[model samples]
Target chain A: MSTVTKVSSRYERDKELFLRYAAIIESSDDAIVGKTLEGIITDWNPGAQRVFGYSPDEVIGKSVLILFPPERMEEEMDILGRVAKGERVENYETVRVRKDGKRIDMSVTVSPIRDSSGRIVGASKIARDITESKLLHASVLEAERHFRETLDHMLEGCQIIGFDFRYLYINDAAATHGRHSKKALLGRKMMEAYPGIEETEMFAFLRKCMENRIAQRLENRFDYGDGTFSWFNLSMEPVPEGTFILSVDITNEKKLQVELEKHRDHLQEIVNERTAQLQEANRELESFSYSVSHDLRAPLRHINGFVELLQKKLPSSIDKECLRYLHVISSASSEMGHLIDKLLDFSRVNRASINKSDVDVGSLVRQVIASLAEEAPGRSVDWQVEKLPDVYGDQAMLRQVFINLLSNALKYTGTRTTAKIKVRSISGKGEDIFVVEDNGVGFDMRYVSKLFGVFQRLHSNDEFEGTGIGLANVRRIIERHGGRTWAEGKVNEGASFYFSIPRFIEQRG
Target chain B: MITRLGRILLADDSRNDVELMLLALGHFNLANEVDVVRDGAEAVDYLYRGGKYAERGGQNPALMLLDLKMPKVNGIEVLRTVKNDPLLQTIPVVVLTSSREESDMVSSYELGANAFVVKPVDFHEFIESVKNLGFFWAIVNEPPPVSRNGGEQLEG
Candidate 1:
């Protein structure tokens, strides 16, 4: 009961283990098969029938070459050779054919099967389908290519910096902005690529953004070793790996702002210089007028005074010719005196301070006319006065203007039996124009340009008794009030003098 | 009829002007009582009894006719000095000048000048104005009595 019974029991246990192994192989998801060295199928499992789309009876005697594509038949021979030599092939990926004539990707392992005599007779092969994994790997490669293309096409300069302050990735724009190629910049330190970026505010900002895990924006000027400078608007963001940077050029805008500021300062300097020169000229004119008023009149008075004493002391002793000569001297001296006085008056108008108020021009003219009528009671003059507008100006200066113009009309029209003087006003663009029309012995229009010039005369002393300063004074006073004056006349018709004053616009709250 | 008063002082730089003024005063028979000084300094000296007139004994003149543009001291300076002095403040001073400048007139009045007159260019008007000035100051306008003690003398 010992030796014979123990040997029988051990043999039965070994047979049971072989049946369990076969059961596991048949139910596995992998295709398990046994083939001979000549590549003929000897045994097939349920997984092999499921994968090849063929049942066990149909493929039991078929060659293993039936499972290979036409171009891969040589691969099977090579695999069978290795298996026959007792060399195991593991996970050798290749193509295979299914029952439906479609191609599939597969990974296979082949091992030599041995008999009890220790001689290799066939190969046991296991294959796994890998089509889904191959498809996923191909799609991942395509996505990487798309991302690289998008970075190359960007407008802003972009760069990725490593924690070691070296370049990890740089786009096309970033390479151009840095004045370097991507091949030269990648894996290179910022100082190595730009040579002096460590000294620049841009490098400092990037370092700060990386260290503090914050975002920052700044402007910096870079000097390229060739004596040229460029300004950039830099923005840096802290990324998980390192720092991301974007840069934009702003050199032209900075240059334009500096140019505009220079022009403004230059214009202000020119204005100050011109104002100083004008003030100097005005001071000289004032001194000249003061001297003319004081010194010039003294000699004229002495000449007239001595002549009068001679006439009074020797009235009977003087001959008619001598007396006439003396009279000429006296008259000429008096005329010179009058001329001097008028000249001083004209200059005073230029230097006097202007005091402005609402002035009644119509009533002032009426008063002047009444005085003229009283002075020339013998002559009958027709006066036509219009309703005049009140203007803002120096009242005394305006009165002087009216007096001069009206007196000129009265003087020129002395020859007329019925002299007509018309004073009227008309509204003009941004101003009020007053015209004094006289129907009298009018002046020749040929000398109209000389009317407002100082000491310029339109008529001889015999024709009109005047020192030729009234119109000049009238022009000066009007000009000081920000107005203009002009005269129009014919040889014998009438003369009309026109003057315009700027209209005042009142400020309202 | 012109009544005689205290001495009249006239200050002028021009010889011809002084001669004419004297001739005009001669017509009023008051020329002897008038004193003529060549410059403003002489006028001041005559009034203060200093310089050349220190030896002479007199009171302040009843009227002083001052010309503005004179050498050594100007009429404005002379007027300022005389008006500030207590003994000479009561003396009437007239600015008679050829300058018709408004600033000169205003300054003369501001300096306590009793009258401002522009000398006429015509000889007849000059003579007539001088005659009227002589008669009015020497006869029509009464002057304060002589202040021997340099004291204030108010006149009616």
Candidate 2:
């Protein structure tokens, strides 16, 4: 039969079926059109008119090539060629141009059209606009790529492990931290890449996070199988695949802490050894002085005793010169004895440990002046004393210092008809300075350096008799108390002796 | 009542000190009242009348002048011996020494020394100290009467 006759016969036999198909094509949201095998449109629906922004009358005789862009025209030809051979092309996604000259995304399906006699004459096509869905999908893919790129470039190591403990992904930092390339670690089991890793504490923690989907953190000193170890502050979180881990290397900080502790311990040991050595030296020095006092004084006593006895046994007619020589011998020997005693006193003050206390230096000075007055009761002395302040020092030792200073003031001023001895103390920034100023026969400034030396004297024995150890003892006592001593004098003028006790001592205690 | 003669014992290691001590005691005319031992051991022996003094028997000395730093035995040990003994504890022991060490003085007093005197370096002061000691212990200060146990031990 002719094609037109066959088409009419099919429609004439199933008028109800023809009406149902016609209504579905007319109401469908997708574009439905009938085209000749040469890619021309013969029938068009309202959906097609809305999709392409064209009316059915304007496109019913037009070729389908008018709907495709130049780049998509080639693909349309391929689709039409397949449809002409009774083959169907389903979901052929492509780009197209609309009547408004705007580009749109589309998914199209084309099938062969058959008459009642089962012969193909043309094709039927369906197309849907998919521009909004395609835009959403492209944005999702871009966001995923951003996260991947960020993880790859981070300084802290980032890694993703699969449920089977295989390395699914490793960032550049993670590969560098592990001292391996990403190509070598990816898709490889952790235990296979790092032997004995399964036995490690880090592995146990990672397993717990992977299996329980729990988050955990730890500090791990990872040993690299090559006898090298590194420290990492590791934080793990449960991810969909298995676990995600971030690691920060802290080996330098750990090593610095260990080195600091070792250095402190070494310093403590050295300090302990030095303290022990000082204590031993002090003990030996104490014993040495004890024997010196006991043994050295014996012979002096005998010499004096024999000299006195020799004088007593001599006759009354003994020569005056001989008698004078005997007197010199006795006096010289006694002076030597007194010098030894003074030397020993100085050493004892120097060697003994001191106990610090608040001392009333003013009252102490008064007491010394009273005692010194007893020694030189006959002298007409004009004493000008000031109120002195208190200080932190060894009470007994400070008393010794005052005794020496006051006695010196009293002795040197013996030449003065009216001795003016002023005792006063002034508070300094870090020290409390006391002064024993005297209007006495002062010394030369050139010899001030020898003022505090042991057995160093400014005057002759005949001028002012002394053992020359008073200032020496004073210096020793003051130094032991962590103080300084200085003297200012001009010959025949007044002399000022100054000593300072540092105030920091009280604060430290 | 058995009257025990008052005898004094002087113990010193140095011959020079012993001679000087005797000379100073002579100033008070009490030298003959004293008996001497050269060292701490000799003094103990004489008190017990053991070795050199065994052939000679006498009463415990009324006073003992002890010096520290002696050979064979020390002054503290002798003082310990005498103070621990009931018979000899009654005799007054005075430590006269050249050592001014506080430890020696503390030890002497803690061990029951009747008096402590540091021997003066000056011969004149030495003689003055001896004059006072001689007059007080031997002449003025009354010695404790010999213990009844000591008298009985001697007589029995």
Candidate 3:
């Protein structure tokens, strides 16, 4: 009777500790439930009631398959059979159905509980909601796949390599031309994959890219094993993790470049040949003109000499008409001779070599004016001489320029009784400009373009006695000195002729 | 008068010029005689007292009028030979030519010719120049004395 009383008291204490554990499990947020080894739900705490939307009374006799998704219930039974073999399952994440048929992701930890005889009595399970973490993992996997697809499928051949010269990745196109598969290519050194590539400029170029840790593009020739060679345009982009190379085959483009260079050389040869022919023709024309002028003088001299003899012998025998005819013929012959001489002079300016010296323009102008005055002492004119600069030029040629200009001024200003002629100098930005201005019978400005052309005249021959070659000759001489000449004039007021010479005479200096 | 009228030598290639010269010489009524040669060779022969001209000339002419352009011996060669000879050097040789080119003028003067004149083209001017030349050389300018040795030889 004492033993039975003792057993009853121990049972009461064990029931109290069980009630305390149940109260703590009910207050927890984690779903705590008990299932039979046959997969039937027997015990459910308030935490399980809130999590699965099922009360303890409603789930006590139901199968645990009520919480599993319909598609996964059979799979759960197989997994539970494994768990019942004394294997505790941890972190088994799966989709489950709640009371309202809503799906939720839960990570489950289940342990098999044992009785005094060590036989499995039930299974205790702890399930937690992890839906947000599962969705985040899925998006990360999708982004990684997208990045890999774009890099592999890009049109330009791309390769990623580690600093140890090991290739981490090569696209499908780059691997196809190689002797190895993409899997075998990874983790292989650059030289080991392509043996001769180490000796090429590409090797040095990659070294530079690595040292600078910058992007570089290299044009190099790659000799394939089959005795064929190809040119590759390689772009190396250095990243902190590794280096990326983008290669393009440019062999056909290089051949086109060589052909273009040959074509360019041929075109230059044609131009050189044409220029030679033109220069030969020009030289022939110039010599022809020189001979025509030089030989023509002899015959005209004979005609003049014979006519003079005829005039003298016919003193009493000739009539006034005959004398006048003889005078006219002689005069015409002389004028023709003068014209030919002037033409030759104009043409010869280009043929001669220039001898340069320091020319004092001031004294040169004075001498020219004095010579002109001596030629026409009877004419009254006011001559103005200005201070002139020293220029580097051929002294004789410069003297010829001043002589022609000043003489032309003196002759044209004949109509004015007290003609005023001004010789002055002015400074231009980088040149010395001199002007021989005359208040004389100026010409129409509209015909100024014709002024420097040989035999171009603005006045009637009877009015102005000239062969009309002076200004043309002057223009030629000044141009040869690296200078320019031009004139401005009105109908009758005056004319000013300006010419400039570069002070720095580089040729012959 | 008799000595002055002794002889004169004219060398010219043109027939017309020679005829005019003779007519103008005719105007000078002095007792001076005139002889004409067609080229420099004949002139050289007559002055050197050679071949055909050995016996015709009583003495060398007072002056020789030399025309420059002729076949065989040219005027410059003739002048050079004459001036080199002791007997012929004393007699003044004047260069007369149709060429008025500066080279011809300068060459004749440089060769020790007494004077150079371009033959004028007009007929009247030609006659007047010849008349003036004749009056000046024949009458106005004093003539160098003639050589007395019968060996009055020319070198050209």
Whole-model Cα lDDT of every candidate shown, in order:
0.85, 0.86, 0.78
**DockQ of all candidates, in order?**
0.56, 0.57, 0.09
Give lDDT tens digits, candidate 2, residues A1-509: 69999999888879988788999999999999899888889999889888899898888878888898988778877887888788999988888889999988999889999888988889999989988889999989989999999999899999999999999999999998899999999999999899999999999999999888899999999999889999999999998888999999899988998999999999999999999999889888877776666676677778788889999999999999999998888777778778778877888788778887777787887888888888988887776677777778788999999899988998999999988888888888888899999989999999999999999999998899998899999999989878999999999997999999888664544
Give the alpha carbon lDDT tens digit for every residue of A324-373 in model 1: 99899998998887888888888888778998888888898899899888
Provide the clashing-pair count of each candidate structure.
0, 0, 20
List the candidates' TM-scores in order.
0.65, 0.73, 0.55
Tell me which residue pairs clash in candidate 1: none
Write one digit per residue (lDDT tens) for candidate 3, span A255-323. Answer: 899889989989999988988998888788665664455345445545665676678778686789999
Which residue segments of model 2 deviate by more than 4 Å? Answer: A1-269, A504-509, B1-7, B33-35, B39-60, B77-91, B142-156
- Over B33-115, each residue of candidate 1 has an lDDT whose tens digit, in order, gives 88889898998888877798877555568789999889999999999998888778778898899877788899888879989
Sort candidate 1 into its docking category: medium
Chain B TM-scores, listed for every candidate in order, come to: 0.90, 0.91, 0.85
Candidate 2 collision pairs: none
RMSD for each of the candidates: 9.2, 7.1, 12.4
Q: Considering lDDT, where higher is better, how would the candidates rank from best to worst?
A: 2, 1, 3
